[model samples]
Target: MKTPNHFKLTALAAIFSCFVLTACNGANSSTASSTADVILTIPVEAVLTRHGEISSSYRTTATLEARGEAEVISKATGIVQHILVEEGDAVSAGQLLAQLDNERQQYSLNKEKAELNRLASELTRTKEMHERKLISSDVFEKLQWQFDAMQASVNLAELALKETEVRAPISGVISRRYAKLGQLVNQYATQSLFHIVSNQQLEAVVHLPEQQLAQARIGQNALLEFAGMLPVNAELVRISPVVDAASGTVRAVLRVANEQQLLKPGMFAQVQLQFDVKADALLLPKRALMTTDNSPTVFVVNAENKVSRKPVSLGYQSDNTVEILSGLALGDKVVIAGQSALKDDALVNVVSVKQFE
Candidate 1:
């Protein structure tokens, strides 16, 4: 239908405006609906359970030690002439450790020997005269006593001279050297020649609490550890009967054979005291448990195919596994990996157990 020009233009403009408004409203509503329908997809992994034995060992670090150790000191007063052995050298009982300048001691011994010879000759003549009735028995007895005294003096002098040559008292290895060549030494002076440590056997001394004393006994099997050697078998040799009043702990000694002589004495040692054993317990790898706020927890698969964190009570842990004291049931799948991105009710996909490994 043909109408006036101005009226037709106005009608066309109104129609275009209405169409633009309707299009704008429809676009806004579509955008809002799309935003509400948005869903996030996250990747996840599954959990599993396995059966294994968990060691109930109380883990502690210890040190190596020698069975018997001593400090070699000089007994006589003299100047050090020579030092034969050095540190880290093997020594045996009665082995020459060091030598002292024994010039004076040798002269004393020689003088005593000469004096004894003269006395012996005098006593012989006196004895002959007395037997022939030319001398009284009292005179012959006095000569005999003087000769015996001189003989004893000579023997003592020889012993003193021999002591100048220092000797080892026990079979061990020389661990230190203090006496040097030309150093003055005396009975009261500090003349530490060497430090000998018996390395054929090693002993571990540990202070255990009073409560653990009853559990410790003689001949009990123990494991010994050192710095560079593997764990070696040992036996409980002794335990102090009385507890230390100040420390309230008893000392325990474990004897270990040192076939390789790897252990040294005076080394601080730690000991693991196995007080009891658990016949059966649910154990899991220590890696499986995660801590949040000091409360130990583990992830388990829920029915909705999601991971849920469950708090667990723990007992003794050893090697790598920890005992599940409570809050876990048998056959429950535990998440060993993919824990970093996990959240409550998060979706999960079962990957191979190798992922945890």
Candidate 2:
């Protein structure tokens, strides 16, 4: 059983080598087990599907215009004697705006009245004589005809005197005044005495693309945005039946109520014509949608922290949100971030949750 020193040393060395090898193998097995226990997961931001309101709209720009505008003109030729109203004055229909010199008209009226009275007295006398058979029938008839002619002349004279006063034809604000004191104005003059604009109701004129013709219906609600001011509500009152041949657009008119007189004509405004709206709908953040495969797609996270890729049918899409028609359910979590790196059945860790405002 005794061995040499050299052989003993060599055997001992071999045993030490085997022990080292066994230790290394055990360490390697422990590391492999730890690695197998670990599961890889992707971090992402998610939001829950919720019910909200959304609308589909067409956007355009237009200028505000007065719904009613008119140029005030004189109906009779005369010298402007009095300027009753100034620019920016509110006037009613048939309100006197100015007065003209009517001395000549008054004198003419007086002369006609005197002649009319004389003729009336003669006609009365003629009638009495005829009734008594003192005057011939032909003479009485002639006197009656003269009296009727005189009466018509007197009426004309009165109308001429009334025309000396200039009046407003419409109810509106006087935008301009052209007539001054002692200025001679006539009906045939091309210049208007005043410019009036009705501002109680305003109009917003916009041209929409021809493709939106079917959706552009009368009585649709529209929103008008102005710079440094609150948005105004308007209604679609008119839409041109024919599309413009040159621009391939349709002219649409939206009426805005300016009862407060806050808006004026020729102001630029941004217009949003809403054609469709969904009051209660399943809404999702538009950022969660992935459109790589033609149809809209979203990565939905299930209860097991696993994401399932889904194709969704979309409805009305508005700012920052879209209406989900199918392929998603309420309370389902959808990945808004890190969705690009995800696949079906991939494990995910929701880093943050966002709620739609």
Candidate whose lDDT is highest = 2
- What's the lDDT for candidate 2? 0.91
Over 1-357, each residue of candidate 1 has an lDDT whose tens digit, in order, gives 766997989999999999999999999999987765442223444445444454444334556577778888888999999889999999999999899999999999999999999998888888889989999988888888888899999999999999899999899999888888888887896557888989999877777778766666677667665556576777778888889999998877778787786566665445554545565777766777889899999888766667789999998777666788897886677777677667777666656443221
Each candidate's lDDT (Cα)?
0.77, 0.91
Error of 1 at 195 (Å): 2.1
Per-candidate RMSD vs. true structure? 6.7, 3.7
Model 2, which residues run further than 4 Å from truth? 1-41
Residue 271 C-alpha lDDT in model 2: 94
> Which lDDT tens digits does candidate 2 get at residues 29-133?
999877754444889999999998888899889999999999988778889999999888999999999999999889999999999999988888889989999
lDDT of 1 at 145: 86
